[model samples]
Target: MDQAETKEWSRRYAGKRLLRSEILLDDPLFQQLINTSYFTPVPSIVRNYFQTQCQRCGNQKRSLFGSIPCYSCGNVHVYCRKCIDMGRVMTCTPLYEWTGPEMDWPHHSNACTWSGELTEPQRKGADCIVQAIQHREKELLVWAVCGAGKTEMLIPGITEALRHGQRICLATPRADVVQELLPRLQQAFAKLEIQALYGGSRDREATAQFIIATTHQMMRFKHAFDTVIIDEVDAFPYTNDPSLPFAARRAIKPEGTTIYLTATPRQQHQMQIASKKLPHVFVPLRFHGHPLPVPEYRMCYTMKKDLATYRPPKAFLKWYHRRKHPERQLLLFVPSIRLAEGLSEQLSDILHDCVIQAVHASDKGREQKVQQFRNREFDLLVTTTILERGVTFPAVDVAVLAANHTVFDEAALVQIAGRAGRSPNDPEGEVLFFHDGKTEAMGAAVRSIKRMNKRGGFR
Candidate 1:
């Protein structure tokens, strides 16, 4: 039980846990470390109808349960289906966690060299984080508007944390955002060991001081990060699943600070803010000192009916002609994949000279389509909400065909609108919502953007 024998391994994962099967070191040495009080084994699957839980994800739902014949224990076993993609977990599964000495700073890297300037509101948000770190706060929210440069607001605090040799991780909700953000973070944190972990990432072997990963990847780490910053916390899967937040907490030290960055927060967070349970800062302005693209509501009756009859919306076609001569990149957001394909083909018939391409989640050439659009190979991109976030096209004009549809919610609408006016050089662009009838979501999105603009002193 020599402390010196396991010191090196303990240093890398002081408060973290890993699956027993994931222990990568020599087997004899791992056993030695276990004997030396450097590791603890936690049950991966918890049992019972009322109390059955996944220790890794804190999922207690009966719907996530499935039974199998245990090979090791030779009995019926159950595991969580929610996180089954990560790995199967059963009653006999051993989730090894490091229960070792507190982290020691043998080396401190220089702060990130990112020389970007933050806007006044963004600076205030960044300052809130610096204060959070100093006070050792548990959680803080940076509730900024879309296109608010939320990532830039994290730079100061993340830089300071790195200078202090505190392990840091910034997790996003999706792989697209991770790919979109990786190169920028790499350039900003040039001197630091930054690792980007997504599906099939090549740089997973790097000894990371800063990690940019999707929420799914966060489950693989336990108590590993000292400062955990989760971006777009209100996005799809993270918003819908409780397991993700559990995974988020499990990925950081219990005492480590957590920050959630989002343009849209859940209703619970709104209530928490009102009750003063959550400390937060709101940045209502975009980084470029521009207002969010306010949506203009236009009635295009029988849009779905027109699509079904292989007819493009007369209103959209009329608007397209008026806006077409300028040759701006148009993103026509449709409600579903089927509509995108149908409407794109219908649109191609009317606008023969214009290249209109449709892209959706299951589209195998989704990336290629987006790239081609960026390269100006297409005049218009008819897409589903898949391109609503984590993508940018300079000076693009956006229109939501059938914006009243349930799929085009306020957050998605806001994000789709955000895609229009991102690049500073082209700060003013149109965001039109052409629908059969406007819904509460459409109305709310328009009002929210206007209110943000008014708050930002927009004329």
Candidate 2:
């Protein structure tokens, strides 16, 4: 080939041969090429042609490789032109490495000492995870009730992977959860290189042997890990997106192990267990050795009769006032943002110097509210299902307003109840579900807890 021909071939070959395993956009050559008009800029298309849908809205219009500027965010994203027209940018990248030469594993040392020695239930849960890791199982469903020390149960498996020098990724659907787990995982693998990746995570450039990231952040990972653990597997975003399952699968080696941790598996997951398609492990109790609190069902009846006249039931109000602890906190869960806001306003009027804050998925002050809750600045937090998982407020009482609301499914209801009575100092608390009528979900939730508690020797 002539000189010009040779250079052209080299550029083409170099670009095509670039490993899709690394999702980092900081590579100088990759950035230059991405900026170059000749090369299409959508990494999702460049990595996974099957993922042509917009990550944000799941719209499939325009070329997967089309380049468009987001009118709303003023950010440039490679998405279908229709998505851009609709003013939504893809929220995830599809780049993932399915296979490559094995990478060197790093040494790991556990930093978090077992607060108390593992109980028998914890040990059993740990054993199941360890077995799955050793067997290179496709999936393992961990059925543990709330406060079961599910994170701690994974320590053995994670430590085993770390000891073998394997790269590990622990992903959850929520950023707050990613933050909540960072310290625990750090303590679990103290001497190992650990990177926590999320939207606002600090070390974007650092690649650690172990990573804890929000599920949305998994789009940035190419086949960069050997073992992947999906915590809160039944949570939102992850459960809603088929792409995340594909992403998690793509993020691992062909022989890599996958473990799922969730207290409440969906119907499909349950079916898998029934058919013997997936190995299942059950931990029916909390580590603190207490029964899951059974939520009492109280129908307001008035809620549905007059939608515009909704208010906390007099019974609920009296209970709230009577049991209100000045030092401890309370969490009131409502079905919708409108209800949460309305209740917060009314509660503010009833209590003095009692800070009542409203939190929802779209609230920009979410982090601040969470921090304030952690710092004990808020006497009460009125929220939606966003705080259903991965949040703990010791000695806090919990009330579910309109518990029969469509949003409070069995898993969600169980998780909401789990939020209370997590600390040993406050081993027990009340969970009241105020609703217009009883739901099958409410009965199931109560029964699920009762069953787990019975199995755990707590009943």
Residue ranges of candidate 1 with Cα displaced over 4 Å = 1-5, 105-109, 203-207
Off by over 4 Å in 2: 1-101, 107-116, 305-310, 322-328, 352-354
Which candidate has the highest lDDT of all? Answer: 1
Enumerate clash totals for all models, in the order shown: 0, 6
Global fold similarity of model 2 (TM-score): 0.79
Q: Write the per-residue lDDT of candidate 2 for residues 359-385, one digit (tens) a residue.
A: 998899998998889788878999999
Candidate 1 structure quality by residue, lDDT tens digits, 171-271: 99888788888889888877666788887888643246678988878877777888999988878889888888888988888789999898877778888
Q: Choose the strongest candidate by TM-score.
A: 1
Model 1 Cα displacement at 427 (Å)? Answer: 0.6
RMSD of 1: 2.1
lDDT of each: 0.82, 0.72
TM-score of each: 0.94, 0.79
Taking all chains together, the TM-score of candidate 1 against the true structure is 0.94
Q: How many residue pairs in model 2 have overlapping backbones? A: 6
The alpha-carbon root-mean-square deviation between model 2 and the true structure, to one decimal in Å, is: 7.1
